[model samples]
Target: MIAKQVNQKAWFMVLPVFLVVAVSAIIPLMTVVNYSVQDTFGNNQFFWVGMDWFRDLLASDRFHDAFLRQISFSAIILAIEIPLGIAIALAMPKKGWGVPVCLISMALPLLIPWNVVGTIWQIFGRVDIGLLGHTLAAMGIDYNYTQDPVAAWITIIIMDVWHWTSLVVLLCYAGLCSIPDAYYQAAKIDGASRISVFRYIQLPKMQRVLLIAVLLRFMDSFMIYTEPFVITGGGPGNSTTFMSIDLVKMAIGQFDLGPAAAMSLIYFLVILLLSWVFFTVMSNIGEESSNGGS
Candidate 1:
């Protein structure tokens, strides 16, 4: 029997990333965890409070409302962006000078800073000297996002769609480009309808990329804070205050560090669980897709 030697040098390559994560993510997470179960007074004084903060947060109406709003917003975002992205990607030119043009146009929105996107939309949605708001007013529509909950929600959603749908389009377009011409040729030889070709060929081929798009959009939307916070200030009376905003309000606005830490942990768990569920379901689908006889 021959002995195989294992290289220990690979771990050295991974050590830097491990140290970075420990410094950046894990250390902060542990600090939060420590705070979640303890009460603190000024001057770094701390008293163990067990699960009191978590219990209070779980029982509070504010947390409940924020959770519901967060999930709902994420759902609406996914529903709108996924289908809209697919439609746009399908319509975009696959080749020629037009391809680069369309890609650059889509990529432009994504390059803007998050706060800048919110600022742009804020001004863009104002009735005075703002294009969208002014146009809506001229059309006789009452469209004040700062005061109206519905308008606030719509503005936030639209801003997200405009900013992030480009990501989905690019991912889907890449998936489309990767599909071999042989599949389309065979479809044409079979005299397949456009709808049939898409259903059987393009869709199946795009499944992996579509899964990636969904997960990315879902996580990003769920954690969205900067854009909405800047646009709405979590106002129109807390109607647009999702979990992230609520956490900020608790931690910074009210100076409730213990409760904020606990709430943050819960919020983190919810996202973690949902992402796991999505990954599991999508992985199974991918497996079945590969296994199914064509």
Candidate 2:
């Protein structure tokens, strides 16, 4: 018997992407690592500072507050959007001309540029001239995001939901559409209630897509910068100043490169860790569902 030799040329085809990633991601990451432990005074002079920046960041009240704010914001939106997305998906027309219309409407929000969404909302939320703000004020509600911290948070959170919930809806809709008709027929023949069908069938099928949507939204919301930056400018006195905003303030606004680099590394690690945990939990649930179904 002759053994066939494996071709090694596939790696050569992948080489370009590897090099591109190294240049774009790895190089900058190493540069940040270099800056994380060094101090700079004018004239490009640098001195080693070891882990002092990381220690300070861990001990800083501002950092802790920003982190808590970021976590809270992510939690609030995830709580709202996941169920909201699932509901929207379930309510959508599954097979009709209306499906395309509904999908297009959902896609429209996602197509808007992030900065444009922020600008549009910023203008749309002004109590003097903006529609939402003006209407609320005319109704005798004191809704001033600019001068009010709670109002500022509310505005930002709403803007994020409007811009991003569509993504979840689209994902869940795709997951729902992929469900086979035979399962529905079986459920109908068995006289299963709508709630039972959903709980036992639809929810299990949607687990994977929801997992993807959750992970994506978690990372996006956690690292959010542009939308809130343009909308609230992180304010009504740091009420909405998230981790990313604070990191930018340290790195660019204050020129604290060492601390900023350390914070960024920590931020990256946190997202990585959390995403892995989400993926693992969802995977285990999926496996258990499959096993139980079997």
Candidate 3:
């Protein structure tokens, strides 16, 4: 066989992107790593502290609490949003004027900025002027997110679901659209029930996009900050203080650079590890299903 020449020039075309990534991501990450290992007390003075910060962070009850809260929030949102999104997507019209209306409505929430979302919800949940709060109060339910931990938690969770579930719905809808009419036709000819049709056709066909949706939602929920911060301010006594919130309070709020840096690195690693696990398990399941079908 004759050797074929490859296009080495592709490397040159990609070099600009590599340089940009190095400057934007790699450099900042290195700075964070540098800060993670040392203590500073003004005048650009930094002293090596080895792993003391990481040790303290690991032992601290505050960090553990924040971590648990973060985990719970992520789990709750994923549990709710995935099913809700799927149901909404399934119920949507396949054609006609309703399609554009439904799509626009779904996309409106996603188009709003994070901070704007928080602000809107914050006002909407106010007991005095907010419609939701006033209606609840008029109905004699003592709903107050500002002073009640349960209310605060509920508000943030609902806020997150409102803001992000649209993303999952859109992705799932796209996946569903990509599926051929032949599958449904075959299922109809076989007289398969709705559940069986979904399980054998729709669900399996949407697996790849569902995986993407799951990963995106997980990461976003796990690191959630702005909405909760603006609405609850992690208040009602640290009830909504997630890992990202706590990290900011430590680094910027208290100016504890060393410990904050350590915590940030640990936070990054935890996210990376969990994402890997999710990808691995889901990919394995996908492969097994494909093999079985083949």
User: What are the lDDT scores of the predictions, listed in order?
Assistant: 0.94, 0.95, 0.94
Candidate 1 lDDT by residue in tens digits, 1-294:
888768777888999999999999999999999999998765799899999998998899999999999999999999999999988999999889999999999999999999999999999999997899999999999999999999999999999999999999999999999989999999999999999988888888888999999999999999999999999999899999999999999898888889999999999999999999999999788778878935
Evaluate residue 253 in candidate 1 and report its C-alpha lDDT on the 0 to 100 scale: 87
On residues 1-294, what C-alpha lDDT tens digit does candidate 3 reach at each position? 988778688789999999999999889889999999999986889999999999999999999999999999999999999999999999999899999999999999999999999999999999999998999999999999999999999999999999999999999999999999998999899999999989988988788888999999999999999999999999989998999999999999998999999999999999999999999998888888888878
Of the candidates shown, which would achieve the greatest lDDT relative to the real structure?
Answer: 2
How do all models score by TM-score? Answer: 0.95, 0.96, 0.95
What is the C-alpha local distance difference test score of candidate 3?
0.94
| Greater-lDDT candidate between 2 and 3 | 2
Worst lDDT run of 10 residues, candidate 2, spans 38-47
TM-score of 1: 0.95
What lDDT score is found at residue 258 in candidate 1? 94
Off by over 4 Å in 1: 1-11
Error of 3 at 120 (Å): 0.5
Q: After superposition, how far is residue 118 of candidate 3 from its true place, in Å?
A: 0.3
lDDT of 1 at 114: 98
Give lDDT tens digits, candidate 2, residues 1-294.
888769877889999999999999999999999999998764778799999999999999999999999999999999999999999999999987999999999999999999999999999999989999999999999999999999999999999999999999999999999999999999999999999999999999999999999999999999999998998999989999999999999999998899999999999999999999999999899999989999
